[model samples]
Target: MLPNIEIIVGTYEEFLLGYQLKQQSEEDGDQVVLKQTFADKSHAGSLKCVAVQGPWIASGGSDDRIFVYDMRTRKQSQILLSHSGTINSLVFSPDLTHLLSGSADGHMIATRVGSWKTEGDWQKAHAGAAVTHVSCHPSSKLALSLGGDQVLHTWNLVKGRVAYKTNLKSKSTLGSAPDCLCWSPDGEHFTLSGPLVVEIWEIKKAGVARREKTPAKPICVAWLNGRVCLAGLENGSIVWISLDAPEDEAAKNISAHEVRIKAMSYFDGTLVTASSAGELKIWSCDIEKQELEHLTSTNIGCRPTCMALLDLSSFKSECPQTSKVVAPKHTNQEKSNVVAAPKPRGVVTIEFEQDENPTIEDDDNSTTSDDTDSAKKSKTNHKKLKQDEESVGQSDDDDCEKSDDSIADFSDSESFGTDGFSNDSDSNQRPAQRKRRNPTPVGAKKAKPKQAKKE
Candidate 1:
């Protein structure tokens, strides 16, 4: 059986020119096909961002256009215009009634989904710097935008103007500002991440709320489970942090990939991570142990920039017979909906060989092992294993409690004023605390050494 739901990944190419995740037969394996590879000639540039809602899929491009396609009809329904620079982010409001797209020119264009019309002055937001991310609040009445100016700007959707802003440069350092931001599921809090730091801020009714900090530079972030948010790092690791934990003890880091993680999404008990090197892996998450078990890894053969999952069960009435639209042989057909187990052949598969244990002969001068001590060691190991099994649930509950206490303390002790932007001069700037990782992965092929100069 094929998965009812499927994953769509956007790449550096023009629209409809990348891959779709699929599974092969039970005997074969899972794979990604370069299936959706055609685009209209009218669209003139590389795609930068994409979003899907119901049967409509919207994509923004370098040509400063937003193209909306009807998946059912397999045709472009609308081409939204009005931005002067590359459109980098397209996010649909939580209620699915509106769409927001932010551009390199530091402007955001909000469009009503039903009418495809621009919403008031949301067109020219973040006038000071390029908007890197735009996130919608759960209430659908407000939104947040993070820009190059190192400020967190909030917009009142109804009023069509900036409601409040906070200068985060003072809390961190200049030029080390946040590049990505995400709102918590409940919309009561949000997080800012850049080099060497992650800051979470509470959403208050007026002005600004409290802020807490942790020390990990995450390239992407998404809420994992209750109270835990997963942050993907430059080293290809995913750290699940509790919002209420103390800064130092908040994060549990798990090295996940060999290249820089570029995109991620979590649903049910599975977490999907994609790396810039074109590798994608699925893992079964254990929220109690704070551990992830590797499930399967697939190489999609292109650098994935973004990803989203649409549960098929929710749209079964709209989805055509997938077997007919997607050829059976071309798509990966599974035996059933079993959680995928790691296969022997993947881009980053590891194979280990075992040899027979070496036999050791003890001579008269050699040290002799004590049978009684060996028995004691075995008993100790047994007791430790039992304790570990019993403490798994207990430890998780205790950590949650401690985190709640720490968060409450921070909220009660912090304060924010209206004029919070920093004005320190060059002489007062702090030393650089973080640097970006190399673009290429380790062990990658390098250019041939240049010919030595003739003597």
Candidate 2:
């Protein structure tokens, strides 16, 4: 069973600053809910990046510190003064043994979990510009860094060497910046989005395989269900691309919000997207048709800059067994329903095998296009998972029926203010309303359909 969507809104006093949300529940088709909230106690900064590792939720702040908190206990766990400038990105290794962080000062640091000591540090990872993002390969041995230089640099952790580098070929005279990057689950390809286009590059070859320009600048992106990709636009919309389709096929656009989308992520088959206007929305993906349909929308009182998914399967396993309690005959249905509380879904485990040679192949013709195309087509033909809509709808209705419950209310809090921080009194206030805008029309020419051929 997938967890319900979780939303976290950040604030200072009464002004909203940022928000983070995750979509985990697929059976109920309900929108993401408010899971947690973080406010800058001193009104000094906002959250920039977030990483979920086991039971810990780590957040990078503009204050130049990485704050780790326990989700279940809702308490601050630890803080690392690891960066000299604003932290731009944070990622957990595949094994969740170490945390990697990049900052605006052009530094990247790997911190060991148990000792909280620096395992390795690189000061000039991106020259003078800030490292925009850092992603560990699914296998964990390689890491990819993207920055203002418009280049993707791959690093070999075991060998301590620069593995490979690639630059995007942009049509814009002003040049293009790689705003977001994501590797497919299988690690055969990676995609980059910037300016007005999202380009998918094949790792086996050194050239661009497919490109689709959107109407607005893309701020964030992620791969969903192996064969489709989701690009979140700065205009508060999302574009869904079918990688298995022809290159010229048009992407399906989903209307999510009216605020600029700053962060997004996918867990299981659910899509969670956040924006600057303090709105967190969740959607369910149709893997076969490559479509994303809206499920729920919640308002967190602050703008959200980053987000992640937490696996809570371990907690369920540790739950204490309860002895049966007598119930009145008239309440038998209620007692039975309570007894049927679903078991938590099993833990999500991803194993990483280090690649000795992390280098990108130099030969463009190393792999035949026919072979690549066939592989992609076969991957896309996977059977679609049948959704239990009736069960899901009933569960959602039951949740709604308990509207008086304190947990169901998801609105903006009064604690957020423009000062970039909040106080204890504000923390108890109701959340504020989210600002919304109509999505920009999908632009022509630049937003043209993608072609089928693999380049």
Candidate 3:
């Protein structure tokens, strides 16, 4: 059965095309038709990358802009100008609350979905190096990105900062960054594609679990299952690599195209592969049987840079949102060379930061007696606070009585006015008028009044 879904493609011709499978009478068979085509209205440059999630389809351009389209309304809804360079990649979180973008400017930004606001962003994610590709974990709590610096960054999505860094060249075998990176749906492993090689790294211990050499250099890759991966090769062929199989065993390979493959995406047993020669084909992928059947093919007549599948059947009227946009946290370890730019302030926000004076946690190796002593000390401090409060209240009352006595003593004293008489009428006495005098140094005689000179 054909899945109720559509594919959106980004082309070098500045055109974003959407295609859906249309079913006809049994005699005619299913057909692929162009559903929507958006041109020129978005950016003046070539479309570099694209992503689709829920009801929104977004295409990033070389002009440093991302145009968001409403698939349900068939209209251009929003445009994001967050990146300063060519947008390299775009991925929506599993919860559909945030759209994460990576650009050639070495920045990774996360934008909120509903309000269309930039929640938090890693200012310079790659330390002034361009981010080649990024993949979000199935849990959406973590992400992995490859950059021009040859480091693979494990981004803590909740903290909006790099959690760990690994050099792809740490091993002599995998000395260069891969062209593609994808997290397995199970979140246990991620596949990295390099020239004539594929590396599957385990997320548990952060090490390579499997490595297999391919017949041709891999250009793009998509996971067909937790253990099976489809790699599109530089020689225009697709190879099914099974991580469960032994290293010496040969995996399945098919000549998928006559030219180099540009990109690939898979969903619900359906695999879509695109060639740099402008051909798009859908295949029925049966991972359990280790079989791939060609279902249908279409020609966009224009070369595509990237493509993403938008499953209409999976659209949600309201998707679960990300709980909160976490502010970036800075630690002493952030001083590493892999560190990027500072926290955000406004629309591209990173409001909260680490405290200047951070409290340290108790060591796990502490003894029970030490814990008991700490508990006892806390109790003693609480008791002391209560005792101080009681003493303060008692002194407050005593001080109030002393103040009353002092007021009576002062009132009992007599007051004298300028008339040299003890007078009880203080309100009737007026202050004597004062004459202006010259400001002179001490011990100097004051100037006589001008009135004396007139007299």
Evaluated with lDDT, which candidate comes out highest?
3
Residue-wise C-alpha lDDT for candidate 2, range 214-281, written one tens digit per residue? 98888888788566788889888888876688876787787777977877878778777778886777
* Number of clashing residue pairs, candidate 3: 0
Query: Residues 34-129, candidate 3, lDDT per residue (tens digit)?
Result: 344444446789988888888888889889999988766667789898889999888888888889899999889899997789998787788889
- Cα lDDT of model 1 by residue, 1-455, tens digit: 33444455666655343333455545566643323434444457776777776766788878898888765555678988878888888888877888988898877878889689887535446654777788888888898887777777888987878898878778553245576577787777777765766656665644223233334457888777547778888888787777667645546678898878888877777777889897877777887788898766777667777776555455434335555465545324554554679888533322223433222343331233354346558978999999998887566555455444565554354332233322345546544212222256578998998998999
- Highest TM-score: give the candidate number: 3
- Prediction 1 global C-alpha lDDT: 0.68
Error of 3 at 18 (Å): 0.6
Error of 2 at 214 (Å): 0.5
User: Candidates sorted by lDDT, descending order?
Assistant: 3, 2, 1
**What's the C-alpha lDDT at position 398 in model 1?**
56
lDDT of each: 0.68, 0.69, 0.79
Model 1 TM-score? 0.62
Instruction: Return the clash pairs for model 1, or none.
Output: 1-334, 23-332, 24-332, 244-403, 245-403
Poorly placed runs, candidate 1 (over 4 Å): 1-3, 15-43, 173-175, 204-216, 244-250, 316-455
- For every candidate in turn, the CA RMSD to the true structure comes to 46.2, 49.0, 30.0
